[model samples]
Target chain A: MTSLVADIGGTNTRVALAEGPGLMPDTVRRYRNADHADLTDVLTDYLREAGSPEIAGACAALAGPVRHGRGRLTNLDWTIEEAAIARVSGTPRVKLLNDLAAQGHALDQLAPEALVPVLDGPAQPGATRLVIGIGTGFNAAAVHALPGGLMVGEAEAGQVSLPVADAEALSLAQFLAGADGFAAVEEALSGRGLGRLYDWASAGAGRPGATDARAVMAALDTDPEALRAAETFVRLLGTVAGDLALQHLPYGGIYLIGGMARAVTPHAGPMGFAGTFRRKGRFSALMAEFRVSTVIDDFAALTGCASFLARTE
Target chain B: MTSLVADIGGTNTRVALAEGPGLMPDTVRRYRNADHADLTDVLTDYLREAGSPEIAGACAALAGPVRHGRGRLTNLDWTIEEAAIARVSGTPRVKLLNDLAAQGHALDQLAPEALVPVLDGPAQPGATRLVIGIGTGFNAAAVHALPGGLMVGEAEAGQVSLPVADAEALSLAQFLAGADGFAAVEEALSGRGLGRLYDWASAGAGRPGATDARAVMAALDTDPEALRAAETFVRLLGTVAGDLALQHLPYGGIYLIGGMARAVTPHAGPMGFAGTFRRKGRFSALMAEFRVSTVIDDFAALTGCASFLARTE
Candidate 1:
């Protein structure tokens, strides 16, 4: 039986069909999310172009929080409801999961090449796993092995107060106070966060006008102040991720996805990501047991959507 | 048809027989855990006292981490294995669970009177639940609903980096530089944590003799500085709880269990615990939807151990 899957993102929607488990899509299609009035239009367009195969089950990975069978996209104005989706797609079985949850479902389905090791540790099967996304925004969730299968719990962890350890806390406090006096993890970790960090460092050193993560990266290529800020950002991110790993006891491993993780790969090692991740006092040994990896494939969420549909069916 | 259940703590061991669902304490007995060399001696004593009834299944909840059918008590030097337990109790089936995990299992068995409300929110059945303990030490774990049933993940979150927001960061930075500064969340939130916070605050003010949570609580009864420190501890705890709630999306509810939670209950309402719990930046609405309650019954973990045996059988 064929099943329909869609991963809706801010800029585009990727839709596909799965013939069976681990089956790569015979035909892949993408639609500009803004071009359509709603998700219905996007699905309809995909169906028309793909010869409208009968879907036994349908699942959509949404880029927002899902509650009460509905979701409102964080980056878009679009809202999704189960009934509305079923009506638009003409499918009896429809389910919605957080995009990160879908990514978790796809973890076991990924090829070995899809994962790039960031830290070396044992990956034991049947252990718990943690998935984190740092791009656009910071979010993470824990996935565990349940009695019958696996389950994923989504988290709005980006806004969880960041843990400032040493001199860094003083620097961040001063920087945040200068820029409206309160800064969340997202304010300094996302694409916009990089720019903010750069601006703070530049102004602190009397060199203003630097903006954005890319510009900060450029500045870091030569400027010591920018380098320190970037270093601080990566270290803080690692500490936060380590805390999440401890909270979830993700001995199965930790997977870092999202655009920010990809961009900051170079800085992760130099910024003491490993040291910070394994720095859990007495439980440091347990944290050391957790293997950390970065997901290099951007299409992981799309594949996850397809995989989720296949499993539910 | 009957199974034996035991909840072994550092100080005491409570044992009971499950004639069926609830406890049959007519067939129950209690013993001091320290008096016995191993669990075998305790079981032998209990069985001998209870007329040595044949048991088909056995479950024991230990106040420590369990791995690979073995448990090492955190407070004591006792190490228990399922095989040794089965042999000692003459039971064919034996299962071991973390005391907190067992407490989570017993949630269904808890009567309404067993809980004291801290914050009110909707409780959705089958939603994920988060269990936190703040007593001698701070630890937390999340239970997720899966296809087969519920799975609990163990967390040593007390050792994770502590969340420091605004002035808290400055305090923590200073604390880190002190002799007792490198402490984790447990250092400030547990029974000992309360004492540590008092010590830090007193030292910060150039008066460093406060010791113990009891002393701290007594000083708070009269001294404004002491009260402020206690209030900060509670607020930071609430903030950490809120962080866990957001990370787990614990729609099932947030359960606060431990000696510290009980001790702070009277001061919780007056100290703005509710306000701090719901203070997550953008996810305040989501945080508000979680029901936060403190487990009032001292025997909650014991009851949970009984329930675990009942369900598995």
Candidate 2:
């Protein structure tokens, strides 16, 4: 019995077919999401190219919340439904899970090359694992290892209002608040958020010329305003990540995923990310016990999606 | 086969006998914790009063973190270990769990009368539930409903740095930098936190006369400074609670359990706790979907301990 799996993101749709447990990909395909009207069209194309093999079950990693068998992408205009996809792919049973949840399910299947350890901790088996992604957007989730495998849960923590501790509050109000007022943490911590931070720092430093995140990073090479902005961005990101680690008590350690984490790897050390993460006062000792690492592999989520379909089926 | 269960808090220790699914209070006893040196003393008294019934298994809910089969009370000097308790009680096996974790395991056994709904949501089965406590200390945990019962995991989220949005940050800094220099969120939000808020507000408003949470609440009956401070405390608490709800995605609902929750029930409404909770920008609609409620019963954790021991045995 073969199972078909798909991971749909804002920019691309990844499709693959699995035959059985620990099975190699029979057919792997990718489609530019902009070219397709919806997931059904891309899935249809995958099925046609793969000769429309009979699939016993199907699972998809969607970039949005799954409720009542349907998910609307946060970054894209695509609305994915299990019934619609099942009909298109001719699969009897289908499951839709958040992409991060699928990433969590795939944690156990990662190869040595797939993982890049950021910190080391007590390697106790069956402990809770916290997975965080700092890519196109910022979000995190924790996976508790049950008797058989792992139970993954949702974390929309990125959307929570950013915490401006003491000195940072002054900077945040001066740099973040706009005419309509500052948005949540994601407004300055996400990929798009970096640009906003850059703009705010530039304006605060009396340089009304700075614009996007790229411009800010480039200016950091020379301009103090850009450097200050970048520094704040990295520091706050680290603080929040540490905050999440404490909130979840991720004894299994913390895994940083997505493109932004990779980009911030160099700054993770110098920008005081580690320092801020470990500064939880009395719980600081407990915080030091956790391991923090960044996952630099782009294909990790795809591999995770494949692993998820295999284990559940 | 009967099991013994105990919920040990700073002020009280509740001991009960679980014959099967129900609790035997005639076999149960409550003791003022201050009267006893440690848990063993209380357990011995309870067992002696109950005719020293042979216990098959024993589980205890401690108002502190459980680590390496031992627990240290957060507010007290008491430290207990499973081995010592097992030896004293003649129980072959003993399990110690965080009070919040134990409360989570007892979710299924709770009767309708046991819960008082503060916010309502869809009755979706199999969804994850979040349990939060804001009393002497603050903490949160998520309970994943598994087959036959619930699986609970501990979260030290309370220790996570409090998010000080805009105005709150200024007030917090003013409060912290004053005479005490206290930085903990629990310093201002717990039973003691309200008092600190009042002190800061009074000082900030140039009135050094008002002190204590109760005094501040009374002053708020007429004083604008006291009212604003009280409102800020509730709003900050609500924001943090909402953040936890989002972080856990407690689609099943958010259960507020602890002494502070009860203390602030009346003020929670007027202080914009609900409004701050539901103000998550794009995710506000999703936040509105969660059911929020305060656990009014003092014996909720005790009942939970009883239910947990019964099921495990």
Candidate 3:
């Protein structure tokens, strides 16, 4: 059976026809969300282009929370509801899931080569796996292997209070706390978080600049401040990842996804990422027992949506 | 059919005969762990005293990690293997689970009166519930409600780095970081953690003394340092609970269980516990949606083991 699957992000929406639990990369089409009025229009146009192939159902992975079968894109001015999507796409069933949950559903489908191991540990088949998305934002979900099916519980870990251990990092934490008096993990771990870290480093060296995350990463080779900022970002990622590994105990593995993962992956190994992740006080050894990996594919959410649809059917 | 269930703790072993999901309080028995050579000896003694009922199966919750159907008591010189336990108890089957996992299984079995709500939120029938045990040590598990059954993923939350937001808490985090260079949540959140907090508070006041957690709690009315320490304890508890809630997104509820839960429950409301728990920067409202509660029963672990036994069969 063929089904329509879409990953609705703020900037772009990727639509594809899913055959069984897998998706063909060539069939996936990307459309700028700004080009469409809403998800219904987007689906209508995509179906027209695909010659209106009959789909059994449609599922979307939204870049925002899906509440009561409805989801509003976080960065775009469009809301997609299950009934509306089903009506426009001419599908019998429609499902909306948090993007992180979609990525969780794609965990098993990800080819072995698509994953890069940050920490090596024994993988038990029936144990839980965690999917963490670190892009414009940070969120996570634990995928539990169950008798009936996989259950993915979404997490808002980005907003959780950041753990600061180093005295140097304490200054950054205080600065990030600002008026709210709370330094969330996202403040130091997201793309904007990278820029903030660079600003802090530059300010500390009496050379503050308004460089963004991309410019900061580009300057890593020649600029000491940029290098320090990137290092700090990776270390904080380690802290957050370690904390989450403990919180979820995903012995199956912790899989990192999204754009920021690509940015951090290069420096993660050299910047004391795994070391910080394993330094869990007395249970440091136990922390080492959990594996860490990154999902390199950009279409994981689409894959997840397709998988979810197939599993439900 | 009656089944044997036991909760093995650091200092004592609790044994009971469970007819179903609930246990008869009159049938509960406690034994000092030090009095037995091993778990088999302890079980033999417990079964003999229980009039040797015709047990179908047995399940034991151990105060340690269970691996490969075996567990070694964290604080006692006893190793309990599934086969050894089955042999000793003469049960058809035996299971071993981390004590926290057992407590998680007991979440639904707990009577309404056994749970004290600290934060009120709508409880959906099949939402995830989190159980955190803060006793001589700390651990947690997220109980996912599955169509077929419940799935509990045990967490080593205690070993996760402590989240510090304020200057005062940062100082304590640094002090507690010790040689490990990390301040694990358990270092400041467990039973002994209370004493450490009190000690830090006393030393800061230049009136250091050998005061235990019980003594500090007893002097809360008369001692300024004790009051501050207790307040910090509650705030930190709130911080940990809030962080775990974000990590797990347990909209069902966050449940506090164990000895320290009782000690800290009184100060929770007055010491800005929920306030801190809900102070999640942008996701504060989402945090508020999660109900916080403390498990009041002392025998929840035993109940959990019996419940697990029944369900697995």
Best by TM-score: 3
Best DockQ goes to which candidate? 3
In angstroms, give how far residue B299 of model 3 lies from its true place: 1.6
Tens-place lDDT per residue, model 1, A1-313, is: 7777788887888887876545346666888987999898888888888887787777788878898889888889899887777876778888888888888988988889988888889988988899998877888877776654557877888877767766656577456532324345676777777777777777778886566677777777788877877887787777788888878778889999987788887778878888777666666677778889999977777677667666666
Ranking by DockQ: 3, 2, 1
Which 10 successive residues of model 1 chain B have the least lDDT summed?
Answer: B173-182
What's the TM-score of chain B for every model shown?
Answer: 0.92, 0.90, 0.97
Better of 1 and 3 by DockQ: 3
Q: True-contact fraction for model 2?
A: 0.58
Q: Residue B116's C-alpha lDDT in candidate 2?
A: 72
Please give, for residues B220-271, the per-residue lDDT of candidate 2 as tens digits: 7788877877887788788788888888888787888887777677778777
Interface RMSD of each candidate, angstroms, one decimal: 3.6, 3.6, 1.4
- Estimated TM-score per prediction? 0.94, 0.92, 0.97
* Per-candidate interface DockQ score: 0.49, 0.52, 0.70
lDDT of candidates 1 onward, in order: 0.78, 0.76, 0.86
Ordered from best to worst TM-score, the candidate numbers read: 3, 1, 2
Regions of model 1 farther than 4 Å from truth: A23-26, A173-183, A223-225, B25-30, B172-182, B223-226
* Predicted candidate 1 versus true structure: per-residue lDDT over B185-274, tens digit per residue: 876788877776777777777886657887778787686667877898888888889878877778888889987888887788899888
lDDT of prediction 1: 0.78
Collision pairs in model 3: none
